[model samples]
Target: MATLLLRFLLKAALAFLAVSVLWVGVYRFVPPPVTFTMLGDVIGGHGITKDWMSLSEMDPDMARAAIAGEDSRFCAHHGFDFRAIGNAALRNAKGGRIRGGSTISQQTAKNAFLFQGGGYVRKAFEAYFTVLIEALWPKRRIMEVYLNIAETGIGTYGANAGSIRYFHHDASRLSASEAGRIAAVLPLPKKRAAISPTGFVRRHGNTLSRRVATVRDQGLDACLR
Candidate 1:
């Protein structure tokens, strides 16, 4: 019985590894139509809205804004930012609601491949997928995919979808400030609105706008360019 169980477990492990590798490899070239987050929304009967746009199809300003707002060191890091992770761990150790310090690459991997939230098992998958994407996909592709799949609002996904729903404009035409607002809400999209100027969002958007310029001036966003 022990021998039989070991064989079954070994087979299952191998199967999982193969599927994970193949799936990540396929998406390196292909645009993913849906993600685990989108699937969850659909299963919960909340209709999903997403319109994938290529990196060039959207405004460069939007990309810069996302970088400034989300991860200013995006171009400098490999797959993870150890400094940010250390800071996050230190903060959590002090006791509070646990927060994440995931980089753009990590978020891209999670959004594209894994589910929204799970315990250690999902985290292990996230780490595996993050490494796969960083190793397999280019930085531009990573940035592009992140912008397109990140949840922007309730039931809304992607830059194009969020732009149309919020500002009634195309993603390519978003002004720096407009793009800033969109990027500002990314951390908590469900509770924030890009169009309406809440005190926090408005201030945060302005900060991102200035940071976008700073990033450009310093060439901190050179990877996307």
Candidate 2:
């Protein structure tokens, strides 16, 4: 009975490997149709709203804002940022709110291929997918996919959708402040609105907006460029 169970588990593992490879390969060329997170929102009566925008189509400041706010070392790291992970771990150990060190590539992997939330099992799978994506897709492609698929607002997905919902404009020509505001809502989209942020959200958005110029000047988004 143990041998039979082992065989079944082995088969399942191999099947998952094959399917995941295929999924990543396909998405390297095609925008992902949907994600589990989007599906869950739809199931919960919050219909998914998304507008696919390529990296070239959106304002460059938007990408810069993401790099400045979420992952300053996005271009420097492969799939993980060990330094950021260490910093977050140390901070969490100090007994405040838990923090994550997920790089944009890792977040892109999760946003594109997996569900939100956490667990060791989910994290292991996320890591595997992150490696696959870094190996299969270019850095620019990864950024493009992340910006297009990331949850930007409640029941809304992607920068374009969020821009339209909040500012009544498309993402093609976002001002630095506008882009930063949208990026700021990324960490907790459901609870925050970019339209009229206050407190930490407003302050963080302002900080990100200022950092956009630094990102551009220092070529922090060099990979995307």
TM-score of each prediction:
0.93, 0.96
Candidate 2 residue 163 C-alpha distance from true site, Å:
0.8
In order, the Cα lDDT scores of the candidates are 0.89, 0.93
The number of residue pairs in model 1 that clash at the backbone is 0
Residue 50 in model 2: lDDT: 97
On lDDT, the candidate that comes out on top is 2
Q: Candidate 2 clashing pairs? A: none
Per-residue lDDT value at 78 in model 2: 90
For model 2, how does the per-residue alpha-carbon lDDT over 1-225 read when each residue is reduced to its tens digit?
999999999999999999999999999999999999999899899988999999999999999999988899999999999999999999999998787899999999999988987788889889999999999999999999999999998789999999999999999989999999998999889999999899878999999999999999999998988
Show model 2 residue runs off by greater than 4 Å: none
Report the C-alpha displacement of residue 83, candidate 1, in angstroms. Answer: 0.3
